[model samples]
Each structure stands twice: as C-alpha cells, then as structure tokens.
Target chain A: MSTEIAIHIQDIHKEFLLSHSGSASLKTALLWWKRRQLEELKVLRGLTIEVKRGECVALVGRNGAGKSTLLSLLARVYKPTSGTITINGRIAPLLELGAGFHPDLTGQENALFNAMILGLSRKEATARIEPILAFAELEKYRDAPVRTYSSGMLARLGFSIAAHVDADILIVDEVLAVGDFAFERKCFAFIEEFKQKNGTILFVSHDREDVLQVSDRCIWLKDGQVEQEGDPLTVLDAYESGTA
Target chain B: MRSEFQELWRFRELLFAMVERELKIRYKNSVLGFVWSLLMPLATILVMWLVFKVFLRNDTPNFSAYVLAAYLPYQFIQLAVLDSAQSVLISLPVVKKVYFPREILPLASVISNFIHLLLSLPIFFIFLFVIYATYGFEVSPFTWRMLFLPVLLVITFMLTAGMAFIISALNVFYEDVKYAVSLLLYIFFFLTPVMYFSENVFYALKDKPYGMLLYNLYHANPMAMLVTAYKKTLVPMGKIDPGGGEGLIPMLPMNWPMFGVTVAITLAFFFGGYALFNRMKWRFVERP
Candidate 1:
C-alpha cells in the first residue's frame, strides 16, 4: 500500500431517494413497485479530491453546500453512488462529540466503548483508559454515570477518546465549537500535536479562526462541487466573500 | 456484502462492549441488579403455576416445568425482537454522526437476552432437580438426548438474529415497525407454546378433517419447532402429578422431516434478513 497519499476520492457521486422515504407500514413495504415513485436527490456530484500524508485540509462552505455530506462520505457513514474512495490507514471519525456514548454508562465504560468503536481491542482500550480519563479531566467522575455530567463534560470525554485512537486520518466535523473556552483550547492544542505527528486531517468548520489556525490548506465546496482550493487564508477569504 | 461481514468481524469486540452496556444499563439503577433478570422468569412461572393449578382447575402436572422449556426461548426471541425494533431508532443520533457496521446495535440486544437465556437455564435445572428429588428419579425429565441442547440453542439464535436484522433495519426506515412488532409478538405468544405443549395443539386439531396436515404444518413455525425441541430434549417425559399419582404424558418422537424443513426455512429467513438489512443500511440516514 502506498503510504504517501492518505485519501484519494475520485469522481464520487451520491444520490438519495426523497420518497418512499420509510417503510413505515406493511402496505408501503409490500408495494415494492410503487417505491419507484421516489424522487432522487443528488447530494454529491462528481466530487474528487486527494489529500497527501501529513496534510491538514479544511472544508468551508455555506449551509447545504455539501460539506457535511462529503465529510460523512469520507467517514463511511454513507457510501458513494458511484466512484472510488481509497484510504490508506486507520480512520477516526469525530463527526460529533459523544457519537456513541450511552448516558447511563460511566466515563470509564463509555471511553472503553468509544475506543473499541474507533477500532481498539479491549486490552488496548483498557490500557489507555487511565490516560483518556485524565486528559478529559473526568478522573474524579470516572465511576459516576455520564448522564449526570454536563454537556461540556460529555464533549470533553468524547474528544478525549478520539484523541487517543492514533488514527492515520482524522475526519473532524465542527466538534471544536463546543465545550468551555479552556477545554476548547486544550482540544486545539491536541490537534496541533496530532498534526506534528504527521497525521492527515480533513475537517469541516464554520469557525474562521479555528479554520485558519488548524488547517494547512483549505477547499471550498459549493452546490456539491469544489469551488476553490488554495492556502487556508485565501480559500477561507474567498468562501467568506462568496457567501456574503 | 462480504466486506460488511468482515467489518462486523473486525468490530466483534465492540459487539461484546455493546452487549455489556445493555445488560449493565438495564439493571444499573435497580437495587437488585442482575437478579432482576432472574426474577422475570421466576414471576412468570409463579403466575402460570397459579393459573394452571390453583384457578382454572386445569391440571397439566408440573406445568412450571412444561412452560420453562418454551418460556426461555420465547423470551429470548421476544426480547430480541422488541428491543431490535427500537435499536436503530434509539441510536439514530449516533448513526447520523459516526460510522460502524450498525448491525451491532441489534445484535447486542439479541445476545444480551441470549445471555439471560443461558443464565436462566440453571433455574430450570434446579427446579427439575427439586421435583425429581421429591418425586422419585423414575420420572426423570432429562434424557441422554439433552446433549443436543447446544445445537437447539444455536438454531434458536439464528432464528432470533435473522428476525433481529430485519426488524431493526425496517425500523430505521419506518418508526411504525416498533409498534407492529409488539402487536405481532402479543399475538405470536399464543401461537408459540409458552403455556402448554405443542402436542396440545396437535391433539386439539386432530379431529378436524385437515387436522393431520395442519398439525404437521404447525412445526414449520420456527418458534413452535424450537420450543417443542427444547421441551422434548430437556424434559423428555412430562408427567402430571397433581398430588395424585399420574402417568407421564409421553412426548411424541421428534418429527425429523418437519425438523429438517423448519431448519431450512430458518436458514432462508436468516439469509433473507441479512440481505434486506444490507440493502437498506446505506439508505438509513438518507432523507429526501
């Protein structure tokens, strides 16, 4: 496997059926031929991009410009209707903080659960549990059910688990715009350290400062296509002007 | 489809983790944590015993033993189906955000209840041990054929997992699936022999013109076949002694040909369910 290119998405397209939306009833489900009434909505159209190893690429776009869909595609939440997505490493998708947390589970348990979901073995997750709790600053509340934790506390724990996964590519989707200022800074600091480790990153965010600070390069998406690509400041400025 | 299996295999540890979470959360807030799982079956036995022996003057003899074989597997299937119908809906937030094989949610619920099934087997054995100890060993419930217990259990699991995959996938598409599953299970409870032997059904319909055919066709119901198999294997001779000496109601021989057909049907259902789930999985988060 070539380790140089981290993610190579070529001419990918995605379509979703707008009708026959759900199998809410036996009648609808049994009427198989009637499902052809579905209206197809193409969310992503012929989008292609490649990220080199150890690059931090930020995606900036207006609402409904297909940024979220593209990140989700990279995260494998949804597959492409056609085209190829070849990736060369472990992927830790931080699409939303507390992505798989059970409110009734304690901090320690949820951390172990999240680590395993992010592709760690029980033994490995156990080994890192102590560090994850310490980093999240939830060591004192480790045994307490996470339902009792504040929203900020939940995001902190969520971010802490993703940080420990040692993933080759990280798909972060606007999760930093959460928690208190101090914790947000800590998360940013971790992202900087992650970048220093030659980790590839594809991130989506509406925060201008966060984008400029974290991304090495930037791509602007509009109407399911790449509108512009260049240095972080230039693309971010262009995206800002176009949206304005 | 093959990659989905491999992905699920790679995430097998997560399956364990999810099952653990389910069992833990189920009883976590209660004073009696794990014992509550035991109490459900115990209470059920007590209720059914009261109904059969005390109230209706219906004497089936060791009715608790009779119901035990059917109840355990029925509870496994029922619990799995009910929870699996809500599995995706409850995890909708996570599904929208993160990516996993997504089958793990339903599978974890099924397996946790399966664990409950395993745990409750001791109670059945203990109940039988006491019964046998009091009433001489001449009427032992278990036979050497009990060795087929594991095979029977796996078949039950396949039937359960197959149903779990389908309902859970359907639930993601339509929230109505949860309600329909509950309604169906309530009706299905009567159809499965949770209260009486499957033989009772066969005997009831024996006088009808199409009786023999219907009786033979009855085994085709996966639940009917499984529960009967369990009862026959675990409690070979079901003799009713309502304080008066009575003869064992000898269990009919295992219907081998019917059993073969039932297994085939269960396999087809299992594969069909897996195929349906995979086909609908990608569209789970799609909204027009």
Candidate 2:
C-alpha cells in the first residue's frame, strides 16, 4: 500500500537506568555495573506508530514526553528494548543542534566530519561541501572554528547540512528553533519542498503553530502514550484546549 | 571480516584526518613543536650513556648505539600506549556525536606516533654516520635485517591499539583510569628493556630459577622483542660479531624467528583489541 510504509513501528518500549545524582561514585558505579542497586526510569511505554511514504507528520508533546527518545530510536541512535522498527529508505536526522561540531575545528572541517558521519562517501561529502557552506551563508566564516560562532550560526550550519542530505525520511527535532526568524522561514520552506517532492518527515515540536503550519497530520503524546492523532488543526486545538 | 573491513575502509579518511589532528594538536601552542618527540629520548639516551658507559667505564661494544636503539623503540612504545589510552576521552566531543568507527581514535594515535617515529629516522641515520666517522665504527652489511623495521612498527601499532582501546573504554566509566594509566605507563617504561639490555637480566639471574622466570617474561614482552630487533639493525658488525677482527670479514643475519614472533604477537593484540572495542562501543553511546 502506497509503495510500502516508509517507517513501521510496532509496540516499542524503552527504559533508562538513572543515577540518584548527576554523577556516579565508585560505589554507585560498581552497583550499577552489578545491577544490584538501581532505579529504572521508564520513558516509553508500549507504543505503536507508523508513517507512510510522502507523509508529513508532527509529534507534539511536552518536555520528557519521550518525543526525543522516539526520534532517537528511529535514527538507530538508541535501540528499542522490545520492539521492531523497519525503515525502508535512507534517514536524515537533525538529532540535536550541531552535535557533530568540534569547538576548535573550522565550520568547514566540521561539515566534512558531519557529512562522513551521515554515511556519505568521502567524494560525495566533498562534492556537497560548497553547497552546504553556501546555504548556511557562512562562506566568509567557513574557515573559522565553530567555537567562535553563536548558537544561531551553529544551528544554521547544522540545518544546512541536514537539508542537503538525500534521504527518504527527514527526522527533525525542533531544528527551526536553533536559528533566528529568517532561518525558521527557511525551514518551513524546506518542509513545503519536502512535502511536494513526496519525501517523508517525522518532525517533533513543542510549538503548536509550527505543528499546524507544516504538518498535515499530528499525534499528541502525553507521558509516553499517544493521547490523540488525526488532522493537525483538530489535534492541536484539542491538545491546547485540554491543557488550558 | 569483509563487512568489518568495509566499515574500517569507509572510515579510513577520518582515520587519517584524526591522525593529522593529533599531530597538529600535540605541537599546538608549543614553540618546540614536535622537537619534543626527539629531545625526550635523546636526552635520556645521553644521560644513560653518561651514567653507564662513561662514569662506569665498563663499555660494552657500540654502547652509545645500543642505548639509542633501545631508547628509541622504547620511547615509541611509551608514547603509543599513552596516546592510545587517552584517545577516546580526548575526543569525547567527536565520540558523542554522529558515529564513525570508534577504533579510528586509537588507530589515529598509532599513526600519529608512527609519523613522529618516521621524523626521527633521518636523525637516527645521522647519528649512525656520525658515530661511524668519529668513533671508527663500521656498520654491518645492509642485509635482510633492514626488512624487520616495518614489521616491528606494525607489531607495536597493534599492541598499542589493543591496549589503548581497552583502557580508553574503561576510562569512560572511571575517571580515575586516566591517572591510573599514566602511573602504569610510567611503571611499564621502567619494566621495558628500553634503557637496559635483556642480557643483564640473564647475568643477574645467574643460576637461580627466579632469573629464568624474569627471562621468560622479558622475551614474552612484544615490546622487548621489537626493541631487540631494532638494536640488531643499528648495531655495527665490527662491534658485536665474534668472527670479526682486524682482517676478518663479519657476517650476521637478521633474526627471522624473532621477527615472526613479533608479527604473531602483534596480530593477536590487534584482533583482541578490535573485538573488545566492538563489544564495548554500544554501551559507550549513553556513557558520557
């Protein structure tokens, strides 16, 4: 149906073992290693979901609602403890704001490293190098270390790299918030292009306006379970009305 | 194996990139740059030569050359282990980001140190020529012995890589391991026969079985064997060959058996290190 589901999620679950404090002592570490003393924080309960080809879906939830965790699972960054996720095409993930950047390395060098990490061949990475720099509009500062850039500058470079990655599915996590208003408009434009080209997107956002503006469909996640799902306007209205 | 090789092959460019980064970072903000790589070993060699040969006045043949050869490989070992051990923690920023093969960090350290060693070669040759010209020493025939150099490098690389992977991975859980490895590497420096000869152990042991145990441990050490092979490469025939005299032509071949041992031990270290790193990588994702 519709040339195979782009992403198939069947009853996924995840739980993390968190320490009592921010850091672990030798004693706590030993206990953690032995699994003799620990507290489990269950993040994602039994949840099933799917996204078809050419679909634009928004995952809306409050902080700690497992939106990031679900995206991480899809990206293969974190494995599901008990579920199967079979994704049919290449994945382009803007997992976090400029996660691959080195503080001391130039923005140009970080682009090269980030491209290679995204599964591009070295030559392919080199070919896309100019376009990425141009899109970020940091051609002048491309040779400067990323540490010199503001948060907005770093996000611009990151979003540019993600947009250039050719993939069937683009997993975005509040990437629009990284840049200023101008880049936010750019991200919405990219979303429109992506949808027109029949590319799949799994976007997570806390902004109802952004969700309603870009996503054709939306799912509201409360705690770890799906609270509601349907058209974006109806779902956003329900989520906002209920919370208010 | 093909898949593993494919994984490594894909990351080879990054490996070279990281090696370049390490070399650059090592000399960064320093006036001397990589001159430190040479000066440390050279200074130690001079000190040992002064203490053992000049002051003691009990000169073994080619004593200066013996100390230099011993110290050079030993210095390489010291650096390879220390750098490898710190590679992962040192690149925590990169490791926490988009994934490539993690082995690139340690392997990059190996390659960086190897480059440092390569830089030292011209100086080593210059030393060889100077000693020969001034001290009336003559080099042995450049036979198959020279082939052992590359082999020795591969072995040291493998051993360092393996140990580095294990230590760096462990350091993720325990911050103390950084200091612990520093102390252990210092101890290993003294234990390794870089400054002293293995023959000294044999002479010290004399007839006691305790000496035999020490001898076994000494030979079993991959680093010792590599250093010994390197010494044989640099030591002149006129000095060590019993068959040599005022007119007698000397002939001593390379130690093929020792070379084979080094190769096997190195492969063992590399495979073991790689396997351990693969097993531990997934856990490292959430670690730091």
Candidate 3:
C-alpha cells in the first residue's frame, strides 16, 4: 500500500435548504414567491478527516448525525458549501443499491447499464457478466424485469454491479444491511479481498460487530462533527458509553 | 464548462448506455416496437394532408411532402424538449446517489429523440418520392444543397439539447417546468411556418405598410428558417428553362442569409442553455 492519501477532507461544511412547504409545485411556488421562507440546515460544520491509502475507515453515528451526508460529499453527489473534499482515485459508491436501475429493464440489461454507468466499458461489463451473475446468485432470473424483483434480489444485483467496478476507493453506506446473511458474508469476504489488494474503503454502518471486524480505524460523529477518532475498539467503546 | 464537457466525453459510454436504456424502455411491452417511430409521423402526415387538402382545400402542390418536411423536425424538437424537461426530476434517485456529469441525463433524452428523428427521415424521403412519382409533381434531384440536411439536423439537436438542459435543471426545483414546456411547444407550433408557407404570409400582407417587416420577422424564427430550408431541400419548385419551356427538374430557392442567422441563433441557444444549466445545477443535490 502506498503511504499517500486516498481521501482528503479539509474544513468541509455542507448546508441543505429546507423548504417550509412543498414548493416544487407551481401553485405553492407562486404563492410563496414573496414570503417564502427557507431554513438552512447545516449538516456538516467545519468537519475534516482523511483516510490513507488502503485503510478501512468505519463511520459510526446515530440517525441524522451526518454520516450519509459526509459519504455523499466524498462521493461527489453534492458539493460542499464552504470547504473541499479531494479524492485521488476512481470511486465506486454503493450508496442505495439499484438507485440507478430502470425498473422496467430486465436484470441483465439493468446490470449492463448500471455497470457502464459505474465506469466500465461495454466490453468489460460483458466480460464480467458471468462472474457478476454468479456472485449475485441470480443467473436464472437475469431475463426478468427488475420491477418484479424482491428488495433483496435488487440489492444483490446492485451490489454485484458495483463490486465489479475497477475502482481505487469504495464507499459503502448501509447497503450491506439489506442483504441476506449469506450475501452479507459474501460481501465481507469480497471486502476482505479488496482490502488485501490495498483498496481504500470508507463505510457507514450501525452494526457494531461488523464495524469492528472490517475496519482498522473508526470515526464517531455526533451533531455533524467528529466526536471521537482512534482504533476501532476504543472509539466504539467511547461512542457506546457516551450514548448510553 | 470546458472541463465539464471533457468529463462528459470521458463518460460517453455511460451516455450511450443511458440512451439505449431510454430507447429500450420506450419500446418495451409494445407489439409494434420501433415501427411506431415510422407510423407516428406517417399518421400525422396523413391527417395533416387530409385536413389541408380535402377539408380546407388548400392547393399547395406537393402538400404531403411539404407538411412532412416541417412536421417531422418539429415533432422531433417537441418530443425531445418535453421528455428532457423531466429527465432530471425523474432520475432524482440516481442524481442523489450517484455522481456523474448530471447533464448526461437530459442529454441522453435528446440523443434518443435524435435517433428517432433519424429513423423517421427515411419515411420523409419515401413520402417525397411517392408524391413526386404518383402526382407528377416536380421533385428536386439530390444536390450539394441537400448536404444542408445534416447541418439542419445538428442545429435542431443542439437547440433541443440546450432547451432540455435549462428546462430539466429548472424542473428539479419547479415541477411546472414540464407543463410550461408543453404549453410553449403548443404555442410555438403555430408560430413556425409548419401549417402555412412563408411566401403566403408575405403575399397576403404585401400592400400593408409593415408587411415586409412582419414577413421578415415571421421567417426570422429559427424553427421557421429550418422548416423552410428543409422544404427547399426536399420539396422542389418547378423551374422554367430559358427556351420558354417548363423544366422537368426542380430547383431550391436557397436562403443563405436566413440559414446563417439560424445557425447563429442555434449556437446562442446551445451556449445559453449550458450556461443556465451549469449555474443552477449545484442546487439540484439540495432539492428534495
């Protein structure tokens, strides 16, 4: 593993505009034209962290603690209002599985499309179809439209496609929690292999045991700022006792 | 913006996949499938020909060909803009989860519709040939001027893409942008010279004081110029030989100045749309 930084976060601040009413509708938008009130919700406030190359960093936080927001920023899904996030390599973000899948498209077709969107060429994606299908254990149902798929099946397909992307860094946000036990174990095995190959990982999870097993370091977030950061067991202990 | 376009180019494969996905989804679960692309414009041409030729009794020679040349391109723009207006809003899940050039969503819609337009071109040519052979109407032979068809198609594409970018980005905030675009298309359909000829508008108000101004202004619409250019290229005008005899071949009355203006306007629309979209795109992730 290179001793360079894989992910760098510097003084990142993010603010979300909360509309008082459902202003997307033209009627409400017109009605609120003059008196519209927008509440700015600061999700992240001057928070900064860095993950070295080949490091597995777990982000553990309660609901609404900005875990998802921080991951989204790292994935470049949203720009920070006032700070910077620098990622040195290609990113494969397993945020919400099947979020880009067209429900009307068949599993095979959706997999091809999703893989291409994730940065694989058509030839590369086609070459990996067999392995992807095998990993998802969904070879028989490849022809069915995803609308007919169960949530678990959809997650499996999404995970399979994302896992195949040739990426230097992987960002996982609670996606493994939706899979079956065997699938979760398979995902961890793949993560272990990925770690062995010196791939950097940033993950958000509520599962304490999974975090301790997968991550060498942990960052505990509270009220949109880092509450603790150290070895996984130490931070987890501090986070648990602080919450309790 | 240059880097943005470069990034989009790097993800060109994704753009192509998105376009393929859209085309596939549109035809899925349908019996006729891609044939609908041909049948739709053909059906519209048929009804338009009937109303103009039989009901209204408008005696425009080669009426089917004329209506088709204008209507096909107009339909392409209409469908592209309308569909793309909702592209960002419809892909909210992907927009919020994944990180790629956000412009690719609406651009994919525009490209798919451009493919549909390309497919329908053969139908237009067939209509021209049929009308020329059966009705004894003089049809222009393929000429260097015919090369302008691709140029016209590209301009139409750029114009539609620009509008799509602006409308789709706005749609992330105001859902009414889609309806507004539909309403604009409805009104714009009449403003362009699809149903009538630019010459007729000129001839009708020839004696008025501001007749020439109105005439020039009417033809100044970029869409009208495109439609007229398409008609000139496809629908031929009977020309007289110097020997006081009617010529069998047709000639196009090329309007180079109007075309230049249309090209300029299209470039403006393309750049303006991108400017507006890039400016408003940051708010997209913050929207619900």
User: Compared with the true structure, what per-residue lDDT tens digits does model 3 show for residues A1-244?
Assistant: 3448998899989888787775566665677663346777888988999899899999998899999999888878888989987888889888476998888899999888888877788899999888888899999999999999999999998888888987889999988775799998999999999999899999998899989899989999998899999999999999999998
Poorest 10 consecutive residues of model 3 chain A by lDDT?
A28-37
Which numbered prediction scores highest in DockQ against the true structure? 3
- Higher TM-score: candidate 1 or 2? 1
Tens digit per residue, CA lDDT, model 1, B70-180 = 888898899988988888878878777778888898899899999989988988898877777776776676679889999999899988999999999987766678888
lDDT of each: 0.84, 0.75, 0.83
Name the weakest run of 10 consecutive residues (lDDT summed) in model 1 chain B.
Answer: B239-248
Ranking by lDDT: 1, 3, 2
Superposition error at B208 for model 2 (Å)? 2.4
**For candidate 1, what is the DockQ?**
0.56
Ranking by DockQ: 3, 1, 2
Better of 2 and 3 by lDDT: 3
* Candidate 2 lDDT over residue span B157-198, tens digit each: 677777777776777667667678789778866776666665
- Model 2 lDDT, residue A142, Cα: 91
What's the distance in Å from true for residue A57, model 2? 2.2
CA lDDT of B37 in candidate 3?
Answer: 81
Reference-based TM-score, model 3? 0.94
Q: How many backbone clashes does candidate 3 have?
A: 0
The candidate with the higher DockQ, 1 or 3, is 3
